[model samples]
Target: MFTLFYVLSLAIACSAVSVDVSDATNRIANGAVAANLQFPYAVSIQRIANNTQVSTRGHRCGGALVTLQHVLTAASCMFEWNADGTRTPITIGNYRVFAGAYLLSNDTATERVRNIAQYVVHPNYLGIPSYVGDLAVVTLSTAFASSTATPLSLPANNYNPADFTDCVVAGWGAATAASQTGANVEQKYANKYIYNQQECTSVYNALQGLPNILPTMVCAVSYDIVSSSCHGDEGNALVCGNTLTGILALHSNCAATSYPEIYTRVSNYTDWVRPIVSLANSFTSGASVLLLLTLIQMTFANLLS
Candidate 1:
């Protein structure tokens, strides 16, 4: 029930980790054209086929460059939705990431094209109700240049997202919720108001008729505008300053109306993520490491997302 700006008064007492408070004004509340260098950490995650990137078609999902050699994104983006409402897991080798591009329509020299050498889905992402622990990290075939594609930092410690006032999400999701083909060719950025844990749960239940909003997640909404996460941008970055804090998890509304956009809180899983990315150092000797990830048990759960 507290306004996000009340954050100023609370900051004096709370031991919460802080980020840039002025970011909200600099980033728009609704969708707007992103300058070429505005968000250098954002990358277009595309599907590759026949060893060629499907770039002419818009990106498959948006992802954040969490490390010079790894990307932080939703685990669900690793699938291809079938007509029968089932998702087929795509091969990790078929994934390609293009960084430092403003528009997908134009081929820019700034693009750092790298194929995914490997990806590790979170051990808890079992496709049950489907949103639990929906996170993944992909190692790039080669590290990107530090100047062109900057990696956003994970919180130095257990960070409270509510401590910061401005949080922005930028992606190439659809302009309108219902338009499948009218997807964003140009990357767009928007400001979203973060809600407290209680309001996040209540607002989701009231607005989307959603039965559950887990503790592992955070919710935000563009209250003054119709902006919300839509089709094609499930793994976009939700950033507050240089910190990459959320990954777009569910954009359940597809009717040109806004609902509480769900994001997987990065702070909650920082411990699990850091090790996965740091392990990339093994690739230094030019030797392939077989990643033995713990398989999530899905035997008793519904597989449809």
Candidate 2:
């Protein structure tokens, strides 16, 4: 069983990517409060403890709205490994997603909260130290109202990472690298530049001696040291222009001079996402009909057997 404590400890230790590192530059750490509705697709994911419906303090991560009833996030956000190396999946009842929420501490009429009905983690995702395909789709119990939250557009099938030189990342993640606190309730954003894969790999390899940066990942470096996502920013959206191009995956050192933040390339997995989102939308629009049809099919198959 993966307890809340275990996940929290891992979050604190990893700081949303890897173990926290000490850095002295404050200029390189400047994330500013996002403008209201600046990121309409942004959503805050709260992990409940003991199957409770209420949001547990300090159990939150960031995610992006992909469809009315679907969200895109990191697979690690929804699953963890047990003490015996067995995988423990988080229950749908343990999650609540808040859309159009700028400050979680304050209640706003504009905010739309929904319980998770189900989730699908990428089949290729393994675990830490090898976060290859760290992606997941979360299906909400109810669809978000269009007035409350608008889904962000996914990248084109032939979207080139090179064309996205100016990218913006938004989340309710920590404000600074040294702060061991949970994510800030206020939304924050920073501008970053996409880095060449080779250049990104060189920096990580030299700093951590781990060449884990894969082609499936997208890399970006902050224009300034203070403009990067730190711990609690995992699963946040990396938007280029109006499209979601990446999902926060890992980082070597938050706001460090040489290290760059890595994200799961959203473009690489569009093939996988399209089918899931289609099914989710269909299920949402015709729940009773689909359920009846599924039951009838199962009955017929059973009789034939």
| 290: Cα error in model 1, Å | 11
Which residues of candidate 1, in runs, are more than 4 Å off?
A: 1-30, 49-57, 107-111, 178-184, 205-211, 252-258, 284-305
Residue-by-residue lDDT tens digits, candidate 2, 50-102: 64423334435678999978999988778644555456787777667878767
| The best candidate in terms of TM-score | 2
Residues 57-153, candidate 1: write the lDDT tens digits.
4367778988888889888777665544566776767758888767765434534678788788898885423478888888888888887688888
Q: What is the C-alpha RMSD of each candidate to the true structure, in Å?
A: 12.1, 8.1
Model 2 clash tally, residue pairs = 6
